[model samples]
Target: MAGGVLGVGIGIVAAAAAAAAGVGAERLVRARQTAIDLGVEDDFVDIPDHEAAVISDAVPLHVEIDDPSPGSPTRQPTVVLSHGYTQHHGVWHYQRKALRDAGFRVVLWDHRGHGQSEIGDPASYTIEQLGRDLHEVIGQIVPKGPLILIGHSMGGMAIMALAEQFPEVVSERVVGAGFICTSSGALSTVDFGLGKQIGAAVHRLGPGTVSRLSTRQKLVDTALRAGRDVEDFLVHRYSFGSDVPMAVVRYTADMIFQTPMSVISAFMPTLLAHERTDGLAAFDGIETLVMHGQQDRIVPRKHADDMVARMPHSEYIVVEASGHMLPLEHPEIVNTEVVALAERSCRAVDSGKRRARGVPRNVTDLRAGGRSRRTTKRAAAK
Candidate 1:
């Protein structure tokens, strides 16, 4: 009996390793096909690129800018995208392409300690610090432009922080914003697919436990790699909703797997302690889109409802059968809403400009004034 049990355990581990390898190979093939289908080689290669190192909270953030399409008008509205915890700018690949194709300049950057950016002080890993980093990114990279801000998960928290910390910037430059798959408060109390008791225990012990676990970095990484199948299962369960393409699921899982445990440990405390419902006030009168997945286990749909209640004027979208990673699972829906928001923002901005310039609000009045000016010029010539 003992020998049989050992054989079964060995068989399971071998099967998992084989399955993981197959998934990795398949994902690579799919990625290549996707790039071909998306015309990335031609459409994406020549987009003008600008890199910046914006200093915020004594940390240098790695920022990248994709200029608007050729012949796009100067001073066009810029869309700035922020990714969630343990994610870098590449997670916004689909959104970036969609917005850039729409002739909007796109800015993407890694949060401090997440990607290529320097991991400043771990003590400064609060959401507020992320918000300040965003403010600095805007001021340095996109100064003097109409803005649309889009954030996912922790990125959404950062946007709220921006609104709370820099209301003046929000009112002056931001025309619209998208908050996707995030919560405003009570995050630690929520059921994260884990049982209530287990979830509660993690919430109570998360920060310190994670910190200690991170100390054995090499061992943890080895264990995680050995359990790739488990990682894939967990990521798919919590991060995605109905019938997500295998390629996307693998891509997202890869990103999560690549994230250093240190980053997770450093940010867990901030996420658990986060509470920013009051920050919704900063978005009052601003065009806001709040989106979440109905099946999201990480941040439940109730959080979305609460946010909508706070900002009654905001558009609320519930992606049915979706999980926490709405942007990846439902790119088309997310892209469409973002484009619509941008269009509405543009109209509002144009109207405000006309008003500021003292132009008549009525179309007939404007036409008459133009005719009168032309007639006066002709009479003067005569």
Candidate 2:
């Protein structure tokens, strides 16, 4: 039994090694293609977040805004994009551009410890703190606009935290919201699609094992650069539901690798213990979109369904072949739905009945990747 535990412990670190491998994927691909091809472009306008409160806090979030194209309608509400765990603001690369092009000002920022944002008190890494940070972003950046909040994974949790922490903001200020590839809670119960018993064992052993490995930063860093191929495979398996380019996988992994293992582990407990189902209450009358991949191994489809069940009016989408990285995997679909969501939201969508999955006329059949409802297969949530 002791040996089994130790093996799992070691396995977690070994798996992390690929994720941490630094110069491997970045260099391997940088030589062959431009940085943009590797998905490393940071061309958006960046206005550093320097609010006194932001500066004085445990740490200041790095925030930026993309103004909607000039001459676009001024009535469009500002859209804020929040990324998932380990991902920096770059995760919303495609979405931000899409929103801005669609004539909506877009605000984006890295979470407290991820990306260029300075790492804060590890103790301050709670989801509630993140929610507070988001509130700060809204208070300072888009203080008086009809707002649309879009979150992915942990970012989604932060939004829930925001809703729970500041119900008034959600009820009064937020006109529309998009919850993508995320959960309201019960994250520990997730099995990464490994099934019941085996998943139970992983949940029991994975956190402590990974946390222990996370402490040996230098060792993990060294191991990270050693296994480029392994990292590629592991990231691919965990992130996307369909085959994507190696550049995309490595690019995604590189972003994940940016968060020091220490910070990653620090945030683990909050994620595991997170429960914000109550937060969904704030969106009861607002236009909300809940989307996830049918093939998502991390949060799974059940989580999305559960969220939709709570907010029956929310438009829930379960992309047929996508996975955890729905925004990256199917940018067009995400952008389309989000833009449509914003437009519908601007007009104040009626939070009506729960649209059940299938049942024709409502299903968006885009398995082949087109927006036409006439497409072959669909993934609309009920």
Candidate 3:
């Protein structure tokens, strides 16, 4: 359901998906299928790719600048990309390059314990602490600018924390916000697209299970490393919904696996307790866009709806057949929407007329873009 299960559950299940491959292809497929029936991850486990996908380049990500929201823009508006749990700024690979090409100064930072950032005190792993950390990142790196804050998964929660803790950040200087594959709160209640019984069971028990596993951190890491192929497959399966390049799948795996089981467990409890719907109010008059994958078993689209309901005027998008990692699975759509958000934010600031503070008078309008989806009001509430 959340990273707690994604990290530890994958460890427990990856062994099944890949370890059994030596037994026989049929058995391997069955084990993979069992993981799928649980509905805990993305298109995660249907079977392995026999074709042997290949990638030509192995480019390293260059992450610069860090942290949370707004202030008046002294120059070109800055776009801050916040990634989810078990991920680093690398998660925004496609979007970062696209945004930079689009001419906006983009900033990215790992949440404490993620990517280049050092893991702080275990006690500081809560979303509240992440929010404060984001504030610090903004102060130190971005300095002065009208910010367009974009968050995915836990990163989205951190943005909500920003809204809650520093209202002025959202109202005074933040021109736009983009919430991707994130929930407003009540994470424990949803079944993660698994049936009610299974979903409830996983959410209830997953965190504690992962925490216990973290105590044997080395063993867990060993299991995780042993399941390297499985990790790549699962990352593709759970993180993305559509067909992504095998290289992209492995890249995602690298980013997530680089994170230790300890850090994953450190943040689990807070994620389970995350409830920041009240923070949605901070972006009241600012330009806001909320996106999620319709097929995302993790942090389902309904959660995006919960956010839109609160910020009636915020734009809502759902990429069809997509999973949790929207930016990676459907880069064009995410890039287009992000560019539009930045443009809107800049215009809003320049015009000095913040959009009206209320729900859009019209219900969400779904535009047919063929391969790319333009979700409006959860595709008119689907």
Candidate 4:
């Protein structure tokens, strides 16, 4: 009788798995159909003169540049966007379009081991290395410019690491920054929506287990393929808040699914060990925005609050009905904040110039002068 019961239980489990996979397949089909109906092909026109910034660790970071509008000012501040773990520069599609339309030059790049970039030494997957990669990308691409830096999730952590290691760059070039859905430290303590005991055990055992598992790439791939539907469901659950469109959810799931498991495993240890609350001090004088979702399960709202407490001057916002993927889930709010910060930074720069020249700080006069200069430059370019 016990043997019969066990067999029945196994059968039930198989049936549930089959049902989930069927649902997931349907969602995927609908998402692709929607994309086709929308004629989204032109949205991905290849960026002209795409460059690669090769880091010291032999990782080639794929870089793309979107120059400001033809009539925009020559000295317009450049906005550099960094994506999070298991994501590439393509994830910044909406933010990029908004920034570009608002007359800001934009820079986007894939982190080493993710996206189209070549995966270099797995041992070099620490946040510090990622910071160095950022530095190199800046030095090689936007060598000299007033800048606004934006990062999400692990990308936010990368910016903090950059501020920690290269404070001079932050002070000298960066005028503004945005940290969205990210934490400075204590990630291990967060529940991550996984069971408390299970989360703890994963945190403790994840690194070593991943290292061993990575050696068997075929086995890992096969296991992942078998569990694709379950993985998609978990990603959708943890990554978004209430009422996200199914197409958007599927799009995000596709990005996550495309990332290699080895890359994910290699970065687990660095993410768990990340601690850089002190780095918040580096952006004290710079205009900064710290945003998070109220219902964020991965990083939590407290992390955003903690960052605000440290950098009191930084603007803090909590999206009411968003989750870990605030950039995609709440693009409009994020884009507005970023554009405002960019304008503020530009005004601050103008204010500093006036102060240095010992001229009276007249906001009206500065605005007129900037407009006149831009007009003159635009005519000359034509």
Candidate 5:
């Protein structure tokens, strides 16, 4: 009897798997048909550079430069900033100021369907498309020069995907990379908290009528009100380590709220299933930095630790008193390391030689009397 019971259980599991596969295939077909009806391509297609070069699609992309002052420092290396899921480029306002002061050009842009970027047909937005958009951005901005790319959360995944899918661009142009509060693979492992919950839901939904309905203004407003307390609860839990400024918190919350659910449904699954563990190979010969809040409840610090292990030469930082939003939560710390890395990378390129790189540094280490200890040691040796 026990053997028969086990067999029945296995059969049930198999049937469920088959049913899920059928549902997924049906969803894809329906989504494709919807795309055709809307006059959008179902597959990833390169968006042509328009006359004004305005980033236009069903989703709009916006770009901002902190310092466009010509002739200030033409050779200064540029740092491209990519914000995470449900966030716009505005989240980097604090870091942007510090970066400009550090004498480096900064490039920040909103992903399609977020911030000032156009949100045309939500059907066209996907992880693959975002990677292509970044490719285009690099082609236009960095061109033949080296670039330092910084990505937060979803943005980090997008950067990794871009490197994986377009190795040529990454090998030729990308000099240094920073992944803050992002996972390289298996995002649904529940270590990423909210990402796991949201990713699974969207994966099952597959971007169809349900996706469009979720993005409707009325539905979002109702959901926001219902989840207001929940929003504050999460903000306090995941957005910082200490008492963060209300403005910064509010700004982040607003950006997230503004992100349509359709966008989330379209790309969340791709991010979760995205396995770019091998993508770091492209940067093996270059500089990389992985920073995450040890206290981060969203994307666990272990993810960053694993990243450093993979890219052993890459700098690994664990911010002690920060959560997932390290860029905003600890802007000073992030700014210092990013600027210093940019300087080192730029000098190496300018000298027409790669220097023997030094020990991988961490923001938290520099903060906790590490710099003072180093200074004292040098003095004693002298």
Candidate 6:
């Protein structure tokens, strides 16, 4: 009788603890959502009748958009943008604005485990699965036309995985590819501080366990305290080129913090073991550009150099004063290069020509390549 009473008491305590933890986590998530100031979601002009689809039954993977123009022969080439780990589609804000302004149809979506998207089983958040999502997105969007894939970090690796997994898709639909501040292989071999180690350990533990561990309020609270300082340092070092608006910086930090711990853990393994040099084959006859920051401490500059060496037909540009977030840090430079690539391709397209240009022109070319040697001599003399 005494033992039975003690057992009952323990059960009651456990139940109460579980309920309290649940309430706390719920409150945290809600607070996080409210604190996040991602500016206006309206940056995307919605396309009428656009709908999101649940890709997998086991996972509530979703794809949403404001595809203003659809089924109109896709007049402009489509660029599908993917964000890095612990980040949402908003990371591409600058690139999206620039691309849309340049008359390109941009498609940006959150990965299955991140952002406003529903988080399903932790197992569903692997890099392979992310690549699969890209494949499906491509199938739905550019069924019969060209696509330009732009990815940063994990997003970039996901693109390479897509190329490897769906060779046919690349051969058929993809026209140009951009890898910004990303690695082409074995991220664990690189030195990225806590990112690589924490990522590898999380991947080994499995997503479900990591998710559960992340729910521990004590751990979450402690990490949150330190994570903020780390977040600020990273944002300053990587995200901004120079001085960014304080509001923007704060908003970006909120998005980064609000990202659930499990989501980060699940995708960590994918980044570490990521090797997609083989994916370069898909860019055989396609235009490819690899950009990296020479000062990048995250993805490391050598990874980009290796990619340039591997992808024979690709152009490699090393931005001198940029970090891992080259797309944000050097938006003008990135924008200019992307625009030129698109223009050159459009000219070939309008002329109904399909000759492949193995080498891409650089900033110097844009400034002087078109001019005659005599004009160059005259300018130099002047």
Report clashes for each candidate as comma-separated counts: 0, 4, 3, 0, 5, 0
Residue 86 displacement (Å), model 5: 0.3
Give the number of colliding residue pairs in candidate 2: 4
Candidate ranking under TM-score, highest first, comes to 2, 3, 1, 4, 5, 6
Candidate 4 local lDDT, 111-223, one digit each (tens): 88877788878799889998999988888888997888999888888899999999999988888888988889987687554457545544555555655655766885686
lDDT (tens digit, per residue) of candidate 3 on 143-258: 78788899999999999998788888777778889999999898777665556756656766667676787678788678767756455545655676765666566666667767
Tens-digit lDDT track of model 6 for 273-330: 7777766767776677777766665566778767776776666666655566666555
TM-score of each: 0.78, 0.81, 0.79, 0.78, 0.73, 0.71
Candidate 2, 172: how far from true, in Å?
1.5
Give the alpha-carbon lDDT of every model. Answer: 0.68, 0.71, 0.68, 0.67, 0.61, 0.58
Scored by lDDT, model 2 comes in at: 0.71
Candidate 4: worst 10 consecutive residues by lDDT?
1-10
Q: In the order shown, what is each candidate's alpha-carbon RMSD?
A: 14.2, 6.8, 9.3, 11.9, 13.6, 12.5
**Model 3's TM-score against the true structure:** 0.79
For candidate 1, the lDDT comes to 0.68
Instruction: Count backbone overlaps in model 5.
Output: 5
Alpha carbon lDDT of residue 60, candidate 1? 88
Alpha carbon lDDT at 332, candidate 4: 75
lDDT of 5 by residue, 29-99 (tens): 44234213323222212121221234534344677766633344544568888887777777676777666
Candidate closest to the true structure, highest TM-score: 2
Once fitted onto the true fold, the runs of candidate 6 whose alpha carbons sit more than 4 angstroms away are 1-51, 62-74, 193-213, 217-230, 238-245, 351-382
Clashing pairs in 1: none
Global lDDT for candidate 5? 0.61
